[model samples]
Target: MRLSFTTISIFLSLIRAPGVVSQTGLAPKQFLNLPLGEVKPAGWLHDQLMVQTNGLAGHEHDFYDYVAETDWTGGSSYYSNLEEAGSYWFNGMVPNGVLANDATIQSQTQYFLDYVLDHQDSTGWLGPEVNTTKPRYLWGRYPFFFGAIQMVEANSSLAGRVVPALHTFVKLANTMLHNNGEGLEDWTNTRWEDFVMTLQWCLYDFYPDGNEELLLDTMQLLKSYGDPWEEVFKEEYFPKTAVENLTNPFPFLTWHGVNMAEGLKALPATYRFTHNQSDLDAASLGWDLLFQYHGRPSGIFAADEYLAGLEAARGTELCLVVETMFSGSYLYQVIGDPKFADRVERVAYNALPATLTGDMWSRQYLQQQNQIAAKNMNPDPFPTDGSYSNVFGLEPNYPCCTVNHPQGYPKFISNAFVTSPDKTSLVHVYLGPFSTQTTLADGNQVTVTVDTLYPFSDTLTTTIEAAGAFTYRVRIPSWVANGTISVNGAQAEAVSPSNGLHSVSVAAGTTTIVLNLPAEITLEPRPHGSVAVHRGPLHYAFDIARTQKVLAQNAQEARAVDLEFDATVPWQYALDTSSLRFQYSPPASGVLPSPVYDSGLPPMSISATACQIDWSVAGDTFASPPPTSPECTGPTTNITLWPFGATKLRIGEFPTVNLTA
Candidate 1:
């Protein structure tokens, strides 16, 4: 007899009554995620969406039609390509759908929802029917997990339609666990269980009463099947001393760059249910180990395939950067640590923008800290990724980044605002131009509108609209010292230094707060005696002129363009450490194009004196030049540096010379 979803069927049937499933579950009280559509992107972030609409993410059907026609049936056994397109549409499109007020956006959202609604099997299985031979291919269902979460968070009616399917899918999944776990063995394939655990826990929180036993049973089984994140970190299995680390032939399965990025939050997310201290410790420890040896100034770790060492010339995958950002968002929710927010800001501001064209039309799969060129070569610097990995195009080397990159900015906007457990305070997890509206515990409506060009300018203004008094919490980043907060033009004392939240009581009606976090330039020492320049969260690089080449577009796909960039200007420059100047310009002040990314225009630029220093190139990529004294062979000239995100060929980590030393 075939196994049946007996446990799940009973749980679902019991909860058919209205209001039986409560909107509460095992998520910790301190981490309350606000409903979507409450906070919308404004200013430069909104401009980014306009640019994205012209890119691969907005026209999903144009570039990724495979997903549109797959019909959620496991076509070729890689889970469901439908999930990929669905995930992007749900995350990237919905935000634009609501914000842009475009009909196409709503129709696109409905396109995915309709398939999910129409195709759910009688046994409650979601997505394409599993091909038992390639059963582990179910890893693709993880995208559906994301899509479901976003749907429930954004729309009540849509969520109402989705919860029943989710419950049924959970039951079907639980039934599969009873049969010796056929497809859940491999490390790479098994990673999907982490998503399952997370979705299950989130659903449990929504329906806590009737389905406790079944949810726990499924979760425990997933935990058993997941990669040994706890043990791996405890034993320091990563950053392995010997190249032959894992005895298995496919060691990259465990040490893969993107895998590690997705896995970073796995344990912390599980901690939501387990509440185990060791799980929390594993998340922190694993982060430290990854950063200690492979970290870059952009707040990402180097990984051409695996944990490449801490050299400036090495590249990190674009997918890893976005995944790390997602992980950081979760860690912040779970741990409430400001440091996680710091990571999120660094990647969003620097690494993410650096990899893609300003217009969001094209992107590279791999971005290097000391990249001097981005052309296609047969023998690329990457160990495993192809030569085209650095090309800016649609699906250059991997389609995963193309599909996954859209999640970063939209999710970042979503995470900008959250409330304290007691609902007496609202926290700004990230600083940008956005407004947050949420109700307090005392039944008071509070709305805070944040206006500023942050990371571009230190001056931020917050306007509070509330009739009653409540605490307002502002995050003072750890890097900012002597930070000042002013209310209604009155200067307040510096409250916290270690990335703490500074709270102040407000008098209800239209209170304005101004925050001044002065940016200071600091030189960070890196591997091979190189240096990275940092001012606030943005990293400064020696900007090299780019030679743009438009490789032909796909004949089959509409407007799908391929691009390659070559370094045109001289890249061999060593900075004079003592002479750095800050130049500020408001948006659209320059002759550059409207969208900052589209024109490679930064809202602010830094002027620094530099002299041509001796640097070598190895196989068309920049080599780590040795540190030298303040001797200059060429005349001292001033070079302008925008943020790392605004440049395609940039020497972000440079060899510095100290004249006085």
Candidate 2:
């Protein structure tokens, strides 16, 4: 039996599930994400987002063929015979346009949404799949719904239409799954967590009493039919070595880079339903092992296409970086671990932007920690990538990163803050220049404004305005020691963080709190006896001078071009770890410059003494792994290092040279 729209609304209001806990012992999420548009970017973070809006991301539909003429928007063709490219664009564009409040972007997104919703099939299937006899692929719908739900949440005016449509689709999906799990294959099967996540949202947030059991059963069927990520994460089944070294016919899905990134949260997502202790333990074990062997200093694992090992020169895909950030964000919310949030910041601040051009007009399909050149490689280091894999341009080597990269920072902003399970407090999950307005459980209206250049600047000034008393919590990154928080100019107290978060009992009215997270120069030992420099959330890299060569350009957008870069200055260096010093230069204008990711724009840097070392490039394109031990080959000179995200060409991992020896 189907419930009418009025009955569905009544049920939703009456049984709005507080959290994803059940009598069957499903695990409860520690935190719940604030609805889209509630958290908005501010200060330098907003500037960075504006850069995205002005660059390729904001203009894709106007020029890029895949998005401009894709079937998702009533165009005549599917992108590469699949709905993925357009769906990816929709996923990123929805949040970006909503958060930026850009009229053009909003109009573009609305146009696409209108088309898809207006043309839904009689069988409740979304998009143009109804007209084709080709096998339906469920993978693309995961991203489409992810974006659709956000659009509905941000613009509630669309709710009456969008919500009921989504329910109809879910009912059809249940029927399809029951009929031998049709349409779930390959990518969709491996990434079933994405589908499960959307279902969980529908079940917990908008479930109708009549179809409650159907939704739950569909989730179970999808899990059963999908790739066994939880089982693959087991010690015996997990691949400890690189994919290249694995025996024939190894679990290819687990070794795939993007799959690994998206799969990281599979067990944790599953634990919510099963509540099995093994699922939780396995999730933790898989995370530890994934990073322990294949991880890079940038907080991503090597996977040009598959899992590469811990060499500094190995490439990490752009898709992996953003997916990893999402997984990290999801894990933090589900498991309530501060480390997950920490890792998300690492990838977002360093790896995500590092792959994209400063203006966000172009991007690299793959990025290396020790990258010194951005040209086509003759003998590419990647196991399966092409020669142009590392080139910084539009759709270099592949188009997935092109369409998918836009979601990185915007979603990061969307999840910057979350409400506690009981909704008594608002938790700042990730530190950034953003503000949030959320209503607490007791009907207290709370508005929080954070003003600071975090990751670049360690000081965060938080102003909380509330209608009544409530607890305010902020995450103290795992790297922070000797951090202090002062309330309303009171004497600063040492921040005593429990489980990576510090709580303050704040009374109603306007309260101002200041957080001083002073960071020290820390060195991480790399695989080749080299050290990677870090200060707070930013990873420092030597800013190598480079020359750009434009290979192709779009007539529609002057800034959109396929480009290659070659280092003009020597990049082989061995640092004197003892000589590392952190420096901060506040912007004179009291505001960060637009396009802040450009070289030399960040207000903070590191100075260190280093000398040219005997290092070589692989295939005359990629930087070879740093030497295990290196002796100086040139006179020592002081070098300035900027944030990894700031430079187009850099050496983030440096070998050490002993001058005394």
Show where candidate 2 strays beyond 4 Å: 1-26, 69-76, 80-82, 130-132, 248-251
Query: How do all models score by TM-score?
Result: 0.89, 0.94
Q: Which tens-of-lDDT digit does each residue in 312-409 have in candidate 2?
A: 77889998998888888888888887878998898889888888888899999999888888888877787788888989888898888888988999
Q: Residue by residue across 140-222, what tens digits does model 1's lDDT show? A: 56666665666667667776677777777777776776565544555534375455454553577664437777776666556
How many clashes in candidate 1? 7
Clashing pairs in 2: none
* Model 1: ten consecutive residues of lowest lDDT: 15-24
The CA lDDT of each predicted structure is 0.70, 0.83
Name the top lDDT candidate: 2
**Cα TM-score of candidate 1:** 0.89
